[model samples]
Structure formats: C-alpha cells, structure tokens
Target: MNLHQESSGEITLLKQKAFNLSSESIRDEIVSSAFRHTLAICQDVTKVKDQSKLLHTEKLDKILTSRLFGFPIMLAMLGIVIYLTIAGANVPSSMLASFFGWLEGYLSLGFQTINAPDWLHGVLVLGLYRGTSWVISVMLPPMAIFFPMFALLENYGYLPRVAFNMDRLFKKTGAHGKQSLTMAMGFGCNAAAIMSTRIIESPRERMLAILTNNFVPCNGRWPTLILLASIFMAAGFTGAAGTLVTAGVVVGMVVFGIIVTLAVSWVLSKTALKGVPTHYTLELPPYRKPQFMNTIIRATIDKSAFVLKRAIVIAAPAGVLTWILANIMVGDTSILMHIVQFLDPFAQQLGLDGFILMAFILGLPANEIVLPILLMGYLSTGAMIEVEDLDSLKKIFIDQGWTWITALNMMLFSLLHYPCGTTLINIYKETKSKKWTFLSFAIPTGLAIAVTFAIAQLARIFGWV
Candidate 1:
C-alpha cells in the first residue's frame, strides 16, 4: 500500500480498462501500430510537399501554371525549343550534309572505278543515300538539341509540375492525369510514350492515354515542323528576328496541337470512350543537377540512335520502293506521278496536294521518311537536284507549287494524325486489344481530317488561296 505499489496498480488498471486485454502489453502494441501508421502517412505528405518546391523557379509556377500564364508559358517553352532546334540545327545539319555528301561522292567514285552499272549506282548511291541522308542531317541535330533540353526539364522535375497542372483537365476529360506525363514521353517517341502509359493502373485510362498520346509532337515530327516554319515564316526576316519569329510560329503550332489534343480527349471521353478518368497520386521527385555527360550519352546513344536505326531500317526499303514508283512507267507517266494525280483531288481538299499526302501515307512507317519520299517524288523527274540545306528544301517545295497554306496544312496534318507504325505497334502491345488499337488509329485520323478540312474551308472562304 506504499506510494510506488499504488502507482503500479493504477497503471495496470488503466491499461486493462482501455482494451480489456488481460495483458498490459496489448494496449502498448495497439498504440505503437497506430503511431507508426500515422508517421508513415505524414512522411508521405511531407515528401510530396518538398518535391513540389522549385529551388530556382522564381515563383514561376504561379505564372507558369496559372490559368492566364500557363498556356502562354507552355507556348513560349515550345517556341524556344523549336527555335533552338531550327537555329542550332543549321550548322550541325550543314556539316553533316557536307560529310554525308562527301561520303556519297567517294562511294559513287568507288562504284564507278569498280565498273558498277548505272542502275546499281542510282539505287544504292542516289536513292538510298539521298533518303537516309535527309534523315540524318535533318533529324540528328534537332533531336540532339531538343532531347537534352527535354531531359533537363524532366531531370529538373519540372515535367511533373506540368502533369500536376494538367491533371484537372484530364479528369474533366475522363482520362488519367498521368496521361500528361505519357504525352510528354511521346514528345521523345510515341512508341515510348505509349509504353509509359503502363504507369496508369486503370486499363481504361491507359488505353485512352495510348490512343491520345500522339497528339504531342514527337522528335521525328519536329524537323518537319521546324523546317516548314522556317521556310514559310522565318525566311522573310533577316538574322535574329527571323529566327525568333520562325521559332514562335513553330511553337504556336505545337500549342495549337495540344489544345486540339485536349479538346479531342474531352470529346472522346464523353462519347466513344465515355468514363471517369481515374486520379493518380503523383509524387514529384526532387530537382537535382542534371548529369550532363550521362544525358548526352543517353540522348545520343540511346534515344537518337535508337530512333535513327528504326527509321533507317524502314527508310531504306521505302527509299527503294519510292525510287521504283518514280522510275517505273505506267503508260504515259511514272506510277508515282499517276498515283499523285489520282489523289490530288482529295489532297487539294485538305489544303495539300497528292504528293504531300502520298508522302504522309508512305511516311507512316517513320515520320522521318516523309521529306525523303517527297524529295524522291520530285527528284525522280531527272532533275539531278540535291537538297543541300534547309533553304534548298524550301526551294523544292516552292518549285512544286507550295504556298503558305500548303505549309500550314502540312504542319497541321503532321501534328494531328495517328502516330507512326512503331507507335501503333506499341499501342497494340500495351493495350493487348486490336479494337482499342483500331480506335486509337481511327480517332486521330478522323480528327486530322476534320480539323484540316475546316482550316482548308476557312482559307478558301477568306480567299487566301
């Protein structure tokens, strides 16, 4: 009955009263488990909050993701990227073209010295060489510049903020917020983006992401857009201002593309694929110093090379086939000419011509191939022409009756259409359903047709033709 014994008895009685456990240890065990769970929950929230902080962001998020500034900042980022791709790409592309052209000359000289026939020289040195050269010269530089910047933003943890900002729109569209992240990946490569859709646990949302992913411009498409913008928009201005305006237009097109994507997603979710978009808890990782060497190596070796190889594989055959189409006569004209003539009506209706439309269809294997196909179609007329630089490309298009509207339509179609063959394959692999894959293909094509049709009609109504 001393004080110490009395205190011990009271503690035991309190524990027993709380849980009715015969053992005093049971109450302690329950309290410990609850505390651990509570601590874990708090840690998770803290981690999320800490990751959202931008060390050097300058409160930019307030403006960058604001309802007013969000769209404009997005456009600025896009324009800057495109401008960098265009202006920075020029020297490297010219160097690459010179090197490749030299190599071709050597290759042709060797073929002649070895007594190779004209047909062999034409097919190998001219056809395949010209096609693959365009891919390397045009694609390599922009990708080298663009991918690293993309990786830097991604590495700096800015992209997650982009996703966070976009989540609500995705939710409204009945798509997953994580779809924004996947769309970012699509800018690298649509196939990779489609694969990244796996991050979404919901099957329905994943399919939606896969189908809509191509709305974002992929690396392969950038060269085409940048080239188009520079030719039609930038060419008028001299020096730095021209560069800025070209970049701005290219960026504007991309922003327009994204707007179209969101609109299409909203429509699809409400109709063909109607459902609620599932929400995901995205934990933004901390911004770290981007490893420059690793990014260069990975972007060059992993991204650029991988994309290049696939494109070359597809382009070589496409080159040969294109050459054959251009060379082989169908009564009075080459098969390519006849085919272009046949499709001209529909192509014109879309504010493009048959050759451009044909290029797009053939280029479906790889967006890198479209310009090459168009070149082959043009060069096959025994012109002895060579596309030595971006300016030369502009000449070809102009000679072929290209107007501002043609360039605009080409850019729009490139932005709006279904992704390439590799992307389609990735979608099929990820979704594991042909029906959804078909839907993926159908939706984008349908939209591309509809949107271009409207633009074409508007242009004609305005007498811009």
Candidate 2:
C-alpha cells in the first residue's frame, strides 16, 4: 500500500518509465516472446487434458475454417440468420401493425369527439403518431429477432473465425485483418461497427474500415431489402421456398457489400491513405455455450431498443414534415409532388423515381423509416402509412409503374446508400475529425449512386427493364 501511494520515489520511477510505450515494437516483441515461451512450457507440462473437448473444437474448426468451405459456410450461415429473422418477424410484425392500426382509429375518433382541429389531428395522429408507430411495428420484430441471434453467434466466438477467413482478402486490400470482425458487427449496427474500429491498431486501416463499413447493410436497412425481396424477387415462390429465396437475395447483397468494401479499401490504400498494411496476430477463442435468454435480453435492451428509439425520435418529426409537404399545395399540386417532380428527371436516370429519391433524402436520419416515407410519398396520403402485406405493397408499386428493374435497383440503392445520421455522428466521434466524417458519408453515397446508375443503364441497354 505504501509503495502504491505517491511519493518522491514514485516520481522518480514515473520519470524512468514515462517514455516507455507499452504498445511499441520493443514491448510487443518482449510480450510475444514471453507468451510463446509460456505456451510451449504449458503444452509440454500439461498431461491427460480433456481430449474430447480439444478434439471436438479442433474438428469443428477444421470444417468451418476450411479453404474451400469457409466462404460458402459463412454465406449459408448468413442466409439462415436472415431467414429466421424474416420468417419469425412476419407474424409479430403483422400483429403489431394491426394493433397500431386499431389504436390509430380510436385516437382519430377521440380527436374528432373532442372537436380537435383537423390539422392538429393530422399532425399528431396521422403524422407523428403514425410515423412512430410505423417504426415500432415494422422495425421492432425483425430487430428483436435478428440482434439476439447475432449476439448469440458473437458470443459463440464465430466472428474471429470470420476474421481469420477474410484476413487474406483484407490484407490484399491493404487493410487490417480484424476489420472483418468490425464489419460483422456492422451487420447488427453500423454506428456500433464504427466504434468497434478501435480494435484495429493502425489508424489508416481503421479509417478504411470506418469508411467502408456503410457498404454492409445494417439492421435498419435490412427491412427495406427484405421487403423488396419478398414483394418482387420472391413473388413467384411461396411458403418456405419464398422465404429461402428472400434470404438468398439478402445473402447475395451482403456478399456484394463485402466485395465493395474490399474494392474501396484497395482504392483508398493505393491513393488517399497510401501505406503498407499493418499486421496483427488474431487469437481465435474457443467456442462457448451462449446463454440464449441472457443474450436475447442484452441484445434487446442494448441494441434493438437503442436503435429503435433513435429511429422513432427522428421518424416522428420527419413524419410531420412529410405530412405538411404532402398536404400544402403549390398551385394545384402538393409541394411534395412538386419536389418529387423536380427530382424525377435525375432520379429516373438511376432507375428510381423522384419520390423514392426524396424518401431516401428524408430518411437519412434513420434507414428504418425509408420504406414508410416512400410509401406515404407514393400514396400522397398526407401521412405515413405502414404496410406489411407484401401483396398489397406489390400492388402499390405496380400501380406506381414499378417493375423488376425498379425493385432490383431499389435493393441495390438501399444496400449502397449513405450511412444514417446516427452512424455519421458515431463516425465523427470515432475519427474526431470533420474531414474523415464527411468522407465516411460521401464515399458510400457516391458509390451507391454510381453503381446503381451503371446497373440501371446496363439493364436499359439490354431491354431487361
């Protein structure tokens, strides 16, 4: 205790160690050598270890980490997780939607009963209330299901295996291998993913991960892609087959996003952030039994609710603005239509209408609200609308002149678009620089526009639309 307290000797000792950085090369080498020697001694001295457990872990690792099977297994596991989320959320989402619809009716009746002003009713009930409820109804169930499963997988120590498998690919792109772990976290939430970049030791590689993380569609954007896949891509199928197809498309998008992340990382390494890639040894922890219920509770409180709360906060006010825009007129047409019309010309070249583009702009605060915004814009109902019925949504899109091309492009655009406001804020916090924050937003937005434009044009040229 006396030695721990401050004294003249403490000052002398601190001065002696002040310039010794623990993470420096000399320190790392010393620690690495110590660990290696210790490990060798332990392995030699240990006897009659749990051979069954060791053999089981080794066998599982052999298959999961195989050169040929690793990527395929990773994709299949992703498909399964997505399938579970989509299938499990379907019934609950509809029930929530119905409950919200029922409550809205009573709220509207209460307003009318009190002789409330029509505009006030519209703002509070139709706009604010509807928008928030839309988020809860649509966003909650899927997130509720997805995050727990994701957390469970993470707790099982599978993410390091992912990093191990993708390390070679990332190294080729001049990025830190552990970026794969951060990128996997992105599947849950990009803001969280940005924060996770602290695990990477190299500032340049960390920035590469931060900038490219948005390409991987997060929890908020998955709803949009899943909805589109259900409505259009899987329309020809039914039951389990339909579900599988939707999951398959989502898996394909995820793979594409990863490819884009690598490509962008390579580009940045060669040009802006040019530097030799740093290397690190990744320790793959042994798998452990994840307590399912505890994981679910933690995931729900820590991830799902946090994201949903942020979405509701933004969606409510944005809903009012959308309602106002849709209601207030410029001459004969509503201001919303006027704006959509203005954007339509440019947006069409991207294979998306003005309303869709405008929705993307308005929904920048939260990706979960993008579909609801687009729905309300399409109907021009002066309020947000929540629809979980794929058939009805398909009909609405068809009425709006949507084709397979529109659906395909919408999925791509959603997958590739700008990071949400929350993610940008987190990026700024992580980077502590306005310059890199702007690049984080700009890089993905530009790529989304460029890629969608190229694909849309190619489809047109081939008469595929």
Candidate 3:
C-alpha cells in the first residue's frame, strides 16, 4: 500500500512505489490515459439535449413490426394480391381460350384438306395442339396478373418488411433472416427461390433454405389450388362473398404454406443441419412509386416468359405422354388407367386414389399440366364431354368419388408436395450434389404423404365422408 497526500495539506507526504518497467510500457500507459480522457471530453460535449427528439432505426421498427397490427396488415396485403390475381385473370383466360380453340379448329380443317394421315394428324394437331394450347391458356393468365403486382411490391422495397416480419420465427428455427427473402421469391418460382439462397452465406443455413423452399406454393401450383378452392371450398357462396371467401382460402393456404416452411426449417435445423442463426442486417428502404409501365412490361415480358418457356418445354412432352396414355389401350383398359390402377394401392392408403397421385407425378414435369392430364383422362371416357367451366370440372371430380376430403387433400398436397421439374434441376445445380437434391425432393414429399395420410385416416375414423 502507498500513502499519498496532495494540495494544501499541512503535511503532504507522498509514498514512492518502485517497479521495473520498460520505456515502451510507460509510453503505452500515458497514450491510453490521454485517449480515454479525450473521448470523455468529446462525449460530454456531444450529449443530446432532449432524448425524445432522437431519431433512429428503433423508432421505425416499432411502427412496422408492432404486434398490434403486423399480422393483420400482412393478411390484408395477401388478400389484396389474391383478389387482384383472381379478378384480373378471368377475362384474359376466356379470351385466350377462345383464340386457341379457333386455332385448333383451323389446324384440324387444314389437316383434313391435305388428307393428312391419322397418326400424323393425331400427333401434331391433337397432341401438340392440346398440349401447347392448354399450357398457354391455363398458365399465361395467372403469371400475367401475379407477377407485375409482385414485382411492384418488390420494387417498392416491401420485401425487407416481409423479412422483418418473419425473422423472429425463422431465428427460432436456426435459419437466417435472408431465408425469408428466398421464401418470398419461392412464391414466384421455387427454382428462383433456391437460386436466391446464394444470399445466405452459411452452409447449414443455405441448405435449410434449399430444403424447405418448396413449402411456399409457387406460381406453378397456384392455378390448381385456386381452381380447387374456388370450386369445392367456396361453391355454395355467391357474388362478392364467394370471391372474397375464395381469396381467403387461397391466402389461408399461403399462410399454411409458410407455417409448413417454418416447421420444416426447424426440423431440419435441429435434426440434420443444426446451428444457430448468424446475425445479418436487413435494410428497409423507403417506399417509392412503382414505375407503372416498366413494372408491367418487365413482369409479363421477362418474368412470365421465362417461366412460360420452361413450362412449354416440359409441358409438350408431358402433353404427348398424356395423349398416349389416354389413347392407347391394352385389351380393354387404356394405358393411363392401367398406370392409375398400378398406383391405386399406394394412393388409396393416403386417402387419394391412383389417378390423382399419378396425375401429380406425371404433372411434376409441370404443375400446369396436371389438371390438363386429369382432364384428358376423364374426357377419354369415349364420350364427347365438353367441360365448359369450374362446375363441370367439379362434376368430373365428383363422378370419380371426390368428397370434400378429396378436395381438402388435393389443396394440401398441391401446396406441400414436390416442386416442378425446373425446381428439381435447380436443386441439383445449386447443391452440386445428388444427395442434397434427393433430400430436397424426398423431404417435402414425405411431409405430403404424412399430412395427407393423417387427414384421410382421421376423416375415415370420424366417418366424415
């Protein structure tokens, strides 16, 4: 201990402490003292006069991420998106169907005039015609309506708010905030979503994103979900309520999809790719006016065309295969029915029959083609059944023993099942490993089977059918 006294004391005695120290150490101590003293002075000078006038990210975060309004606002926005898509798609689809139907008729007449061979006529006129036309008619309208609005939202910088909204739940799953961004992209296309996983730097988190990306129903599956939900779920209601209810169910499936995504992410993170979420900042840009003309042009011409081209490439072969399956017969049963029968046992165990399952598998080449193939299978009834609208389509399903349970299963399966061909290829390319690609495919498919099985078995036990 050292005793010391200073400053106007009667007897000031200073105790001297002796230590062996290098000159460099003494200089370092002096420099540290000076630096801290300067910082203290600067801090005192810069202190704010009023705390309430402070502006920072925290204030902005409170308003955007408030518990009182965040989820409700999210649902409202989702409703608006679906409502716009449904309202905008109807007239365009009808117009395109009429134009394509005329073209098919013209091609048939031209073939007749040329005395075309039966096989030639069937292959080109019927197979290609029906395939390409169905793709164009069914796939085009939704893309046209959904993409521009999505792009506008993106361009306006609302995407980061989406990330902010989903971050806490995602963090619980040990996934990165950017995973939400990739999932949002999946709503446009799963392939694109998988590609966007590049933003996530961690291998474990990136893999989780890749594996669970398909949980958000992509644009490909939207038509099937929308059509079925509109037909079976909301059929009793009429007018505005019907539209709203249909949109509501569609949005509900979207919400359900997001839930499945988070659940799957949590499971995968804990079981296979275990880790904690690494920190990353999400910048929320100020909202800006969406360029009206450019938004539409880029959405339709660029985004829609890219997806459409992929669909066409996959759908053409699928269409021909579907046609063959419908036309060719073995003894008395057609090849399609034979295939469906082969799948029946497995499908029935899950509450879905062979035809429904087979159609989905075949349509994996493109989800847009699933309904078309199912239609072909139904129309091949060796009768001229002209399906005009949603009601007629529901009748076909009803004739095939589709209860409300079937409709429910169909919607769930469409939302949770395996992704399209492009997504499969994208997975393989992104992972650069066959193992991961297989896992990506198997995981969702396994969930789909499990969920469908539970729903079906429960319903059966309760005699809900």
Specify the highest-lDDT model's number.
2
Q: When superposed on Cα atoms, how far off is each prediction in RMSD? A: 8.8, 7.4, 9.7
Which pairs clash in model 1?
none
Score every model by TM-score.
0.84, 0.90, 0.85
lDDT of 3 by residue, 1-465 (tens): 112222212122111111444443443344544565555667767986665534543465566677777677777888998888887787887888788888878998999999998767776767766777777776788888888888888887676787888877888887888998899888878988899999999999999999999988887788888888888899898767888888999999999988998888898888889876675556567666789899989889987678668756887777777766667889999888898989999888788888788789888888777777776666664211225587878888999889889888988888888878889999999889999999888888999999999999999999988
Candidate 1, position 262, lDDT: 83
Off by over 4 Å in 3: 1-61, 381-386
Model 2: residues with Cα > 4 Å off, grouped in runs = 1-38, 45-48
Can you rank all candidates by lDDT, best first? Answer: 2, 3, 1
lDDT of 2 by residue, 1-465 (tens): 342243445446545664674434443454455566566567777974577877777888998889989888988888899999989998998898899999999999999999999999999988888888887787788878888888888899887788889987998898989899899989878988999999998999999999999999887888889889888899889999999999998898999999999999999999999988776577778888999899999988876667567756776787788788888988999988898999999899999899999999888877878888899888777788876667888999999989988988889999988898889999999899999999988888898889889988998999988
TM-score order, best first, reads 2, 3, 1
Cα lDDT computed for each candidate against the true fold: 0.77, 0.86, 0.79
Better of 2 and 3 by lDDT: 2
